[model samples]
Target: MRYCLGLDMPGDAALIAEYENWHTDIWPEVRKSILDSGIVNMEIYRLENRLFMIMEVGPDFSFDRKAAMDAANPAVQRWEELMWKYQVAIPGGKPGEKWRLMDRIFSLQEAL
Candidate 1:
């Protein structure tokens, strides 16, 4: 399955640069955690302060499962805490949420 999500970074150029630098060499533990959670592929894009993410997951993937796993892993928890320094919940996102799921309004495959 594929999932699209959005987030926002602080509107500081330095902070945004730091965030991008971090992604350039994500920690091995963080990458391992994602793979173990059944995420086959992931990509992130940014437009000013707005960030977009696309994830492709294996059949066994579940957001609940991933959350539980992340909660139990100290490294994952640490990574999230560091990331939160530059991230904020998108407008209308639930409290404590960073990434907001995007709704697909149109798909060429569906139209065809």
Candidate 2:
């Protein structure tokens, strides 16, 4: 299923620049973890400090499964830790939630 979510980066100007650099090509290990967790497609967009992401997850998507896989892979865990250094949860957002899912409001594809 396709999922839409949003997150935010640190608002500091310098930090935002650095975050942009890192996203130029995310860590390869991180990509492996996501793919191993059943994320078939992913993309991220930004507007100033706000970030939006779209991911196509498999039917078996499960947070616990992903978490467990991440925990088992130290390289992936380390990558996540490093990435988190630059990212901050969206203001007034849930503590552990990085990307908040968006509800589907309109979709022409839905009718197809």
Candidate 3:
């Protein structure tokens, strides 16, 4: 399965630079946690202060399971805390939500 999500930065150049730097070398444990949660591939892209993430997951993946695993992992917790410094919840997001799942309104393949 594939999912797309959105997030935002504060539009500060310095903060954006720092956030990009952190992704250049994600902590070992955080990477491990991601793989363990059944995420087969992931990529993040940025356009100014807006950010998008694409995630491909295996059949066993579930958001509830991943959330529980992340909650139990100290490294994931720490990483999330650090990321929150640079991330802002999207306008319609629930309180404390960092990434908002995006709704796909169109697919070229489906149209074809």
Candidate 4:
């Protein structure tokens, strides 16, 4: 399955640069945790302070399960804490939520 999400980053140029730098070399532990949680592929894109993420996952993937795994992993928690320094909840997001799920409004597949 594929999932799409959105996040907001600080508009500061320096902070945005630092955020991109971190993604250039994500920690091994974080990557492992994602794969182990059933994610097959993930990509993040940025347009100014708005960030979009696309994730393709295995059949066993569950957002709730992934959240639980991340909460229990020290490295994942650390990474999230560091990332939160430059992230903010977008409008209408739930309290304490960083990434918000995006709704798919149109798909070309349906036209075929």
Give the backbone clash total of model 1.
Answer: 0
Q: How many backbone clashes does candidate 3 have?
A: 0
Q: Give the TM-score of candidate 1.
A: 0.97
Worst 10 residues of 1 by lDDT: 88-97
After TM-score superposition, the amount by which residue 17's alpha carbon in candidate 3 deviates from its true location, in angstroms, is: 0.3
Q: In model 2, what is the error at residue 21, expressed in angstroms?
A: 1.6
Candidate 2: 10-residue stretch with minimal lDDT: 90-99
Task: Give the per-residue Cα lDDT of candidate 3 at 1.
Answer: 88
lDDT of 1 by residue, 1-112 (tens): 8999999989999999999999999999999999999999999999999999999999999999999999999999999999999998988878899999899899899899
lDDT of 4: 0.96
lDDT string for model 4 (30-89, tens) is: 999999999999999999999999999999999999999999999999999999998988
lDDT of each residue in 28-110, candidate 2, tens digit only: 88888899899999998988888889999998888789879988998887877777877788666667767677888999988
Off by over 4 Å in 4: none
Better TM-score candidate (2, 3): 3
Per-residue C-alpha lDDT of model 3 across residues 57-89, encoded as one tens digit per residue: 999999999999999999999999999999988
lDDT of each: 0.96, 0.83, 0.96, 0.96
Residue-pair clashes per candidate, as listed?
A: 0, 0, 0, 0
Q: How well does candidate 2 score on lDDT at residue 69?
A: 94
Q: Which residue pairs does candidate 3 place in steric collision?
A: none
> What lDDT score goes with residue 41 in model 2?
93
